[model samples]
Target: MKSIGSKWMVVLFVAVGVFMLFNGRAQAAYPEKPITLMVPFEAGGGVDGFARALASRMEKDLGVPVVVSNEKGSGGRRGSIALFKSAPDGYTIGFPHIATLIYDDTLGETKSPVDYSKYAVILRVDTATFFMYVDKKQPFKSVKDMKSAGQALKFASTGIGTPSWLIPSAVGSAAGFRTSFVSGHKNLAEAALAVARGDVVGGTGSYTHFRGVIDDVRPLVYMSDKKSYHLPDVPTIADLGFGKLSTLGVPWVIVGPPGTPEDKLEKLRGVLRKIIQQDEFKKWGLENGYEPDIMPPDVFWKKMGELKEVYLGLKPQMQEKK
Candidate 1:
């Protein structure tokens, strides 16, 4: 009886040991399969282009295929929610704008499908500066001229609540201009083409995204205080009059679903850091008109917190949409 009892205990111990080993091996062998990268915008847009490029490089570093899935709607909220709802395994991740991530809660837009706190921030990949462009045929050469005209100008944005919309709205409110906003485009390309054709007098969004259409439209001013590297000749809003109203470049962030293991998150972050630092990635980003402003997880989180405060302060002005 004593020998039988001892034998039973030995079997149980071996089973427990085997289970622990398997668990550790599973945890360490993260991203064993192809990873899905969700892009919350339509394909062929600037964000989509950037996501594809980053994914292509990341696959080389990670040794796994990174697939980009386009989930468009609700100003990028639909896909964001989907990404959040996905399993916390490292296989599922998302690339979303910083404004969409921070302002979703404050704007009462939609309950984030993913808990931001649970996800690991891989890195801040890029900052795209929005430009205020007017058709070259328009009489107003500069913002001062347009402001002095005092007539309401028609402006087109990607949508009502997007940064492309909000930045122009903020500028209009601060500069005390009667600006009318028209929505309906999926991204800046359509709106930019509309502005270039004189369907809309002005447009706003990343200058790089619109650089291809600059021949038809002339940039009036930058939305931010600092000048844009892509359009260095153009003056910034601060260079005009509305110093307090100037905004910064929108940051692009890569995040995994909540409950992703720390080690897995660190692995993603490590690959991203390496990719961002690579000369090929940097050159490609610059050539495509993106600034390589990579930030680590801790710093990126702090910036997200700060940007939330800034967006909240602008919420009141955002209500008075024309």
Candidate 2:
């Protein structure tokens, strides 16, 4: 009887030891080593630059080195899908354009077949104002003039569902102007160049993105109610008598895969909030012509939900291509 009891006790001890091992592993703190931040766009673009700058600062705040990895393809669907499939232990996160993640899900652009709601919201970093620009040789000086031209003007975009496309579509609807779209470009630089060379009449993009090329083109009007910092002299769409049609604010968000622990998510948000408030980060954003609009995790999530609704309402129009 004593020998039988000893065998049973050994088995029980081993089971307890194994259970503790896994429990400890599960409870282990996030970012035990270097963390990877995935950028869905190609390197050297505005979004990629923002990710790199923010990641550099976040590394200091988190006390861990943050590495940026580019996974470009399929209108940013490839990187986002990979992010979703990654382990939710907070080691991997994605900096995805809000429109691509929220609107594309409804449009069937992403192949991962996962819903946007599955991701954990971290923080909203900044929102940029978009501008419409035409070549200097164009006869139109303002949006009204451009509309009166009474011809379908060709426009270029980075791709469908990007801000480069949505801003133009929104302005076209509001201004009663027809635009022809040429897509499948690898980056915004190519789209901007296409507009400059008159391959297209104009293109819509952030004022910051066209800083160097502003001299080659004429700024028609900003899509937002407020004038852009980069183009303070330019009139807004509201200034052009299109106040009701003016709606332009694209948020840069940080998100982790779904199923991440609440505590871990909160930790990441807390660190990001601290980093965003830093004077250096704010200065960098201001210099780059971006508005620093930071929000708490919960508020950010609520705002995303609201924007999702807005995008859903515009789905029909967005689906219609020129």
Candidate 3:
């Protein structure tokens, strides 16, 4: 009953409506599908355990399964690459420590696919607090005793470029002592075990990773300038005259691949904020030696940039060793 012109207008309006409807459906709230959390460590490790626990809690909040995928290799480089290569749809995220993210590239170990800028850092859950520990039954109790031995102490290392290696190397260099690393352990737990079995003189890593084996090791010194809240009686590396070499603890950040939608990022951030707030999470963190210190995206990324500069300064020294 309408004129040809009016009919065409009606058809155009309907077409636009249909297009918009489909577009709306396409852009529907993020995480319509299950999200994947890529943990760059073995199943039994602390990072893996934390990822699984967080995924379980996130699933409750998201109403969608938050699956944990262990893509362990290259001292976490493999998992980080997998995370970098994943589509930027907010479906895949990575839980790699700050050190691993920059280590490979900084040391020229390998070319990483991740564009550090493209990574949308979601949260910084905690900082890695390392302690220098020796076997409880070892003959030497103090650094002076080890120094007086007049030989290079055999230290258990996770691998080259990890905190396990860097911390000890830095301390030994600063303290004017000699150390030789025996690399091959998968994680700090294994390294600590090696120390216990007399395979190595000492081991260094996060206190959380060493908690299970603390009974078998004597913590010689904390790596931070200040004493750890958990190990109040322990002396800091600074107090022992190696303060100049001590780097701030490495940050543990959760990051999404490039081009992740801002809204989606915020949604996940909110969920994580709530997750960290849960009493159960807080209790577990304390038990595991993880300090609950969550930071927003801006602050987290800013700190990451600052830490990168610190690593850059250390690169010349690292290269000299190579």
Candidate 4:
């Protein structure tokens, strides 16, 4: 009887040990299900492509499927709102620009459930300086010619509060010209297409959007202190004498909903850090006009804060144009 009782106790001990081991493994498994990546733009555009590429690479490292969902509207507001309002289970994340995330919220134009401050930015994939593209059919030969034309010109913008409109408006204010905006284009490609088709006199967006139509449109000036590597001949807005706004560059961030677990966030950051370091991702970035610099969470948030302040100072000017 004593030997039988001892055998029963040993069996119970083994069962408890097995249960503990499985529980530990379960707890460590961060992404037990597929992850959804939210892109706040139309499919087949630059941002969507970036999301798809990033998702593909992340899937390998995470051991789970990464899906890209396009939540197009309000120049990234719709997707960002959805991301922030999602369950904090580390499943849904968003890729949104800081400017668009804060645009409507800052201006009080409409009620927003998610403020830019609420985002837990995990990584910064790239940055783009604004560039102005003119219709190839237009008589303007260069930035000089465009400035010399001295006529109120139409510029295509994604919407009222988008960087597509804000950058051009700011440049117009600083450079002493009048700009009439053709707002409500869905994406940067649409804005570029409008310029290419002569639907608008010109348009403003990052190079990624304009690169495809480089032959169809003339890149006059980029809002950078130095000439872009891709557009070596084109002068910068600073060189064109609007040096004040030359520092503006839109950063693309990967943000998770607030209250995401720190461990999960770290896991994401680790995977992205590895992904961006690969030669394939680097080559892809160069080809796609994406700057292959990975700003980690701490640095990204700090840069975002500075950018927010700069935009806040520039917001009043943007709003007056409305």
Candidate 5:
């Protein structure tokens, strides 16, 4: 019996060693297969466009197909949950709205499936200032008009967890107006379309998806510490005296599932760093409303932590009835 047990142990040890050796090589040769970049929104939405553009650039550098998969639902949490729960292999990376997810998971009354902090933070890819846009046909031309209208204006958002909901809700409360959010649009483009078609009074998002409908929907308020370069005449939320509702616009970050191999993560990060430094990539982001803000993994995660603290400070307001 002792001899048989010894033989079995030796075989087991050899098997384990072989597995580890192959795994290390797999990590070293990351992207041996096509990488799947899971974007948690509909295809035509802001996140999807950004992901596809990023994938194109990544493919050029990585020399492998970078396919974008849209996993739309729960205002982003659905696809995000899929991403975080996926295997920690380098091939299954994704773009998760870590900042908004932080707001949803921590201060929100209803919890989300994503743990916000569970994923591997690759880097902060882009940031855009939130803007409130309303259809031109709407009677209100400005925030002041909407405030004094004395009726609750209907608004739409991709999900309750997104800035489209939070910004409108907070801004309405602080500015002394009654407003209600229409949720379940899947993404900002749909919400913007709802605003254009008069399905809702307005919506808020960084990318308004106003290409052909620029004249149709007009921006009412910008939610940033400063005015946007394009909308220099518009007023920020702070400028309108809602300093308490201060918010850094939405951030889209690239991430991997929890426990992704360190070597694979580093390899991916190096490729991204090269892409981010490219002039063409930076130009593309600027033109697409994707403010190219680059940060290392540690710095980006630290900033996310700080953002969570800021959101926590706004918990009282977030819980208030809109």
Candidate 6:
């Protein structure tokens, strides 16, 4: 019996050694294959542009191709579902519409839109400076004009629950006017077109979206306390005494599927940190109206919680467009 026990101990030690050896090699050989980044919007839009810009540099550093996959629908619901269902390997990462994530997780009465458990946040990239742009042809030039007009205005929106809708709706309510949308356009450009072609009076979106149609639409107010350097001419929501609504902006975040290895998550965070710190990346974001902010997972999740509460408080007013 003593001889048998000694033989079993030797076999166990050998097995442990083999396991460690293979595990080390596996981790060292990470990213041997290409990575797919899922963008929950159509190609050639602001979100897609941001993803491509980062993916270009990520591909060079990671020594593998980084492909961007566009999965457009339902204000980022379709793509989010696909992303969460994807294997938790580090190769798959994506951007979920933050508003949709918050609404689906807490506010919505229906079943959860996506698997909350499978969502693992990597880091936050930046927040957009949202603006309400009025068409050049409209008599309304600023928030005051829209309010004083004392008439219902039609605007374009991505969807009902999205920032594209909620912010504008809330602003209108605050301004003492009823606002409705020719809503359901997929991206900023599409909604901006409705403004340019004079389909609707104007719509709200980030500076990048309106950049493509700058001449057709006039920026009225930025949804923040401070004016963007890129759009120095535009006033802030705070300038109109609505500073509390300023925190509402489209936050761009990067996320991997659930169960991403700790090593890979750390590596990704480090690599991405380096990328955000680059002067060129910063310049690109500035020019495009993205305030490039990088935060670790802990800080990112904390901010997410705070934002949920903010929106939750506004939910009642928004639902009724009060």
Among these predicted structures, which one has the highest TM-score?
A: 6
Model 5 per-residue lDDT tens digits across residues 1-322: 9999999999999999999999888666767889999988778877788888888989977889999999987777778889999999888998876666788767777776767777887877776678888888988877878888768888887666578877777777677787788888766776778888989889887753654466678888887777776677878778888754555577777889999978778878888878877899888877777667677888877767777777777678778743
RMSD of each: 2.8, 4.2, 2.7, 3.5, 5.0, 2.5
Q: Worst lDDT window (10 residues) for model 3?
A: 242-251
Taken over the whole model, the C-alpha lDDT of each candidate is 0.78, 0.76, 0.79, 0.81, 0.78, 0.82
Task: Give each model a TM-score.
Answer: 0.88, 0.84, 0.88, 0.88, 0.85, 0.91
| Candidate achieving the largest lDDT | 6
How accurate locally is residue 220 in candidate 3, as Cα lDDT from 0 to 100?
85
- Candidate 5's C-alpha runs over 4 A off are 1-27, 243-248
Candidate 2 Cα deviation (angstroms), residue 72? 1.1
Across 1-322, the per-residue lDDT of candidate 1 in tens digits comes to 9999999999999999999999989887777899999988889988788889988988887888999999998778778778878888889998765476566666645655555655567777876678887888899887767777657788887676677777777777776676787788878888888888889888887866687788999888787778777778898888878665554457788888777877888898888888888898888888987777788878877766776776778777777763
The TM-score of candidate 2 is 0.84
- Clash statistics: count for each candidate: 0, 0, 0, 0, 0, 0
Clashing pairs in 5: none
TM-score of 6: 0.91
Q: List the residue pairs that clash in candidate 4.
A: none
The superposed Cα distance between candidate 3 and the true structure at residue 141, in angstroms, equals 3.5
Off by over 4 Å in 3: 1-26, 109-113, 143-145, 241-248, 319-322
lDDT, residue 178, model 5: 77
Candidate 2: residue 20 Cα off by (Å): 11
